[model samples]
Target: MRHARDFAVTVLVLGLLGVVAGVLWSLLAPRPPYVMTGEGPFLADPSTQALIADDGWFAVVTGAIGLACGAVGYSLSRRGRPLAVVLGLAAGGLLASYLATLVGGAVNLAPASITASGKAVSVFPGPLALTAHGVMYAWPTLAVGLFFALEGIAGYRDSPLRTPFGGQDPYGPLSSYDISDR
Candidate 1:
């Protein structure tokens, strides 16, 4: 019961934090307007290529959700280090997420547009964007979001219920309710 409660509260808090972080991050660099002619400053090069590709609102929302998940996991598993769990694996996780996004973003099968060309360029049907986005951006971001949320959960571990099997939650016996009854 306690662990369950912890998980729920932790998840909620982490979810909020992730949403906030994601929103703020997006605000810092909101999607620039799509220029009709050439590329802008955010794009990769001056070759009329739009700088930051529009990932859509879905990315922002889903990214926040994923971050919340990671935060929840971190909250459940951390040791003495409060911020350590989230902050600890953050860099590595971010890198993994980015790499995954790159791989997923690959449009090898169905060719994409280079610039303002509305013509369809089809090669294969192996779109990797969503795949890469999931690993590269989703998981790590959620992990960081969970870190913030778990901080609150950690504070509520006041009673520190001890189980017969020396486990946090009881799969066999000595859960929060049973232990109290005993």
Candidate 2:
């Protein structure tokens, strides 16, 4: 029961962090600098064009999320968790971030302008849409990668070495090696 409760807390914290990340991305994302000033229902306005042109920014935001995930994964690994637990946390964090992006999209308000003849009216409205591209998957992938990298680098000793007979330090390998020889 304790393990389950801990897991739930971890997931909850990760999700909240994901929402924060999403909000930050929405606030920081680049948007169209110009507004439409023509008549006849200009659907493909300059703002829309700018959005299309800046598709790379989405990936950038995802990469930032990935780095955050990696950091969290690394921290978890350092806690002596089993590999599966670490991986699970990474997956949870990614899912949370994805959900967060959707929330962010819904809450995002951007400046929009509609023009008729020589007059223009500007309004701040929710964003057109938020999308999750395949590139966004890199966030979780990178998290797993970083977790392993950190685990290897830190050389955390979660348990004593065991042999097929389940005896710790069965071979005395560490005793055989001289630290000065390295």
- Which candidate has the highest lDDT of all? 2
Q: Over 4 Å off in model 1, which ranges?
A: 1-54, 57-65, 81-83, 111-142, 156-182
Position 58, candidate 1: lDDT: 33
For all predicted structures, in order, the TM-scores are: 0.36, 0.61
TM-score quality measure for candidate 1: 0.36
The alpha-carbon lDDT assigned to residue 124 of candidate 2 equals 45
Model 1: per-residue Cα lDDT at residue 146: 64
Q: Write the per-residue lDDT of candidate 1 for residues 1-182, one digit (tens) a residue.
A: 54455544544454444445444434433233322223422322334212233244435544655565565556556544444445434644554444434433332322234433675432222222331234335555666766666666665564344233455344544443554555
Q: Residue 78 in candidate 2 has what lDDT?
A: 57
Clashes of each: 19, 0
TM-score (C-alpha) between model 2 and the true structure = 0.61
**What do the candidate models score in CA lDDT, each in turn?**
0.44, 0.59
What is the per-residue lDDT of model 2 for residues 32-144, given as tens digits with 9 covering 90 to 100? Answer: 44434355234345446546533455556656666676676567545445455465566666776586567556665556677757776653443524443564465566666
Q: Enumerate residue pairs that collide in model 2.
A: none
